[model samples]
Target: MADNLPPPSPSTSTHHDSTTKVTDMDIDSLVHCASYLTLHDISNMVLSCKFLNRVVYSDTIWRRLYREQWPEQEPYIISQTSCASAREAYLGRYTDLQRFKFVDPLVYDVHMGIGAKCSDLMFSNNSILFSQGPVIKILSIDKLLEGKTSIVSLNDHRARITCMRLFPLKETSLFRNKAQRNESVLVTSSSDHSIRLWWKGSCQRCFRGHNGPVTILSDKLLGDGTGKVFASGGEDSTVRLWSMSSGGKRGGQHALKATLYGHEKPLVLMSVVKHKASLLASVSKDSKVRVWDTTISSDRSSCCVGMTCVPGVPVGIKCHDSLLYIAAGSSFVAVDLRTMKTAFKTSTRNQPKLFSFDILPSKFLACTGGVGRAMLWDIRRSTGTGDADPMAELDGHVGPVTHLHMDSYKVVSGGREDPYVSIWDADTGNQTNILRSSSNLNLDGGGCGCCGMAADGFRIVTAAYNGEECVVNFRDFNNAVFYGAFSDNVTGSKFWCPSTSGHDHAGDESDV
Candidate 1:
């Protein structure tokens, strides 16, 4: 059999002797083999020759090859192969297929009071804040865990409350003559077309300006101490800035610092970059993302950076350092502010309706949509040629996922399903926990509609459609403790809950 076998090919003989010059072998063959190898294997093969490394690391070729094979049925190697023989020959050489694992669920739940639909939920420190109908309720998990019941209801708003934010109180020598830090306050916007400022036990003041419902409120303190201001975006297609002062007096009232007008459609979300307090970004239903310069004089309206526009009806917008991330109809796009251009765009494989997204401090984005799924994207590596694939898909909710919250290592998503809250490991995509609101606690004949996770990554708060709110803490997931609940009294529409922190009430916590 050895004698009958065909003679060794020239390519095979070329590598037999240490002194043999392999330069005469076909370069195309070597290039083809290198393309089929795994990134790890390719690195080893490149050590065999300088030419191999040069070809393998060529940005143009690898980028083109990567774009052609992502999120598809074909293996990257097979996609690069032009001939059936080459594909068949190389398929066996590369056997490592990326695998994803789903882990056991985290167990916890929150009981609802009076069975109502909850629209939004938020978590902070040891407390959870949620809204149902027009009312926002604050629950202290520490108090609940200790079996000491105490729920604070802030329902002073005349109309349905749409969004709530905890503003942080920063001490300034000018404001505090005795150098005492002021107590933090809660800033809330509502469909009633007003913004209310609340302190520990009272609704301090209400600012009226927007003609329509207030959608989002984002505030940041500017400068070290002298001047501090905040911004609020509304469905009225207007963004306003307010100056913080000592009292609720008209003299210290919210100053219409700057009016941002350009969104032809409703503005859905707003985020302020802490490093650049003058820089503010908003996403709107008009399929556009706008960046504004809020530092401009109040007399001069803020202008939008139309040049860096992201196409699509943006449902979510987040900014960190030099990057701007936007979520539109099943896709997310990242733009570099330095270049004022889109760097990468990736599909979420779902529609954009009734979805909410949150980006953790580590550049991980968690998005939930009507598909009843929450997906996490590792955006740090998504640049240059193509977008990064989703690190993991979280599937547990039976209804559309409405809201998502994530920290450095974990994710919490809420939807209208049996399990109201689903938690996951941010890196591994493993299901860390399933927090189910008690069926007996069902409100408005539906499950929790939207939810929020704590900044510390330990608590989840959810709201039902019928006007009910619930909070759950992950620390006691195995025992599945039910923290607390609140009832809404207005339109019976769902309300949003924001995590309760001294900063949330004071507007000092970094925006997500």
Candidate 2:
């Protein structure tokens, strides 16, 4: 009865204390408090618990977590947060994972020299062309498969060849009514300050005007039915146009059409789009990219002069459809020709010195930098609103990556590293093959400093700075072999030329 007496009536006088204390707990502690939850679960926890809600809703904590766990999604996450209502405005825009195809390098070769620096490579038809010093090496892609030893060397340039382009013409009877039925022409530029045209079995004419070394050269098919115009740019800060026709009295001679000059520095890269037949874009060391109109007036048979300068020091430029893509510094920028304005810019987080870039047919752009890393960007989905990230980062190269070349399914990177040439699957970023330079079959002391790679069908060609060149057939992986090696002191660029007539055309094709 005493224990139940109104619960002992409570004390009338009580001591009261009025003080609020805040704890110095770190972000990690706050995150750990919600350890039993996933990210979505944390969001739910935030709604139900005030303390957990404040910690989860902290922008600094979330941003740090986003970058640490998913760097590629940082751009999209940041952009989404800038909206007034991120939950409703950007619900489907930010996914934090990417899948890539990995390829291994199957073949490897090396070339060593004092000042070897391979500049370019091309794969055309069945032949491969690479430049070193003042010569172009040509070889047969098929012979490499048969394990035959035959290499054709052409001493065509007085200086080091810097660039090359294969002008693809149709083999149809309607197109080549008079000239060689299925032969193709290779256009090359060199430090000897000249541009030359060459056919497989013939030494063609040279275009001379630049006082300095020719830096970049490219061509586009203009008009129809045997009428075509080729364009070239050089260190002389000029772009020249030439018309190719069957009416030449001499073989491979075309009429010079026009010369456009506005660049203050040597042109490093150039690209032409088919949609804008009269429009051409060039990037120079002067830190500017210029666009020119090549359309001819009704009365004046010469190209019309219209130019615009875009600000940037572009190291590489590529165009697909009506969109122009340029790689500058650590960013890749895309411009729409229709709007003549930048549409997209994505950061690679790489250092500025880059040697080469290649765009795949799947709209993925691969860029290599001086820092020995290669990044793949999905430019098609990247918008200025920042909703994209690099799909993959290739980190195998030990030194600076000089060049990147890609086909529909595979990618090859060249630089100063193990296995001078490395091949990967474009879809998964997985290594499919390792082309080592240490094989006994290699003649160029294993391999040289690979500068560029080009592919035609299943055959691949690699050019090195030490004047070493190799052609490999990937059809037989276990027995995949090197075709030939050119161990000359050639440098600059190399490429492959495929002959429509099913002729062997692989070699160390070089300029200068």
Task: Give me the displacement of residue 292 in model 1, in angstroms.
Answer: 1.7
Tens-digit lDDT string for candidate 1 (1-512): 88999988988775655564556556666566556666567667568778666665544344333434332312233333333333222221121111101111132355555544554555655666766667777777777777665678788777777777765555221234433254356778888888877655567666777768888887455434556666777888887777666454443354555677877776777778656777777777676677777666644443665435555556677778887777776677777776777777776544444366677745555454547677776666555433345777787677777667666556667765544566666666776445444323444455434444443423334443434445333333211111111111111101111122222221111121
Per-residue lDDT over 101-161 for candidate 2, one digit per residue giving the tens place of the 0 to 100 score: 1121143333323444444556556666666567777766567556664457678688888
User: TM-scores across all candidates?
Assistant: 0.64, 0.63
Off by over 4 Å in 2: 1-119, 169-182, 223-226, 246-254, 297-312, 350-353, 364-370, 385-388, 437-448, 464-512
Model 1's TM-score against the true structure:
0.64
Weakest lDDT window of 10 consecutive positions for candidate 2 = 95-104
Please give the distance, in angstroms, between residue 458's alpha carbon in candidate 1 and its true position after superposition. 3.3
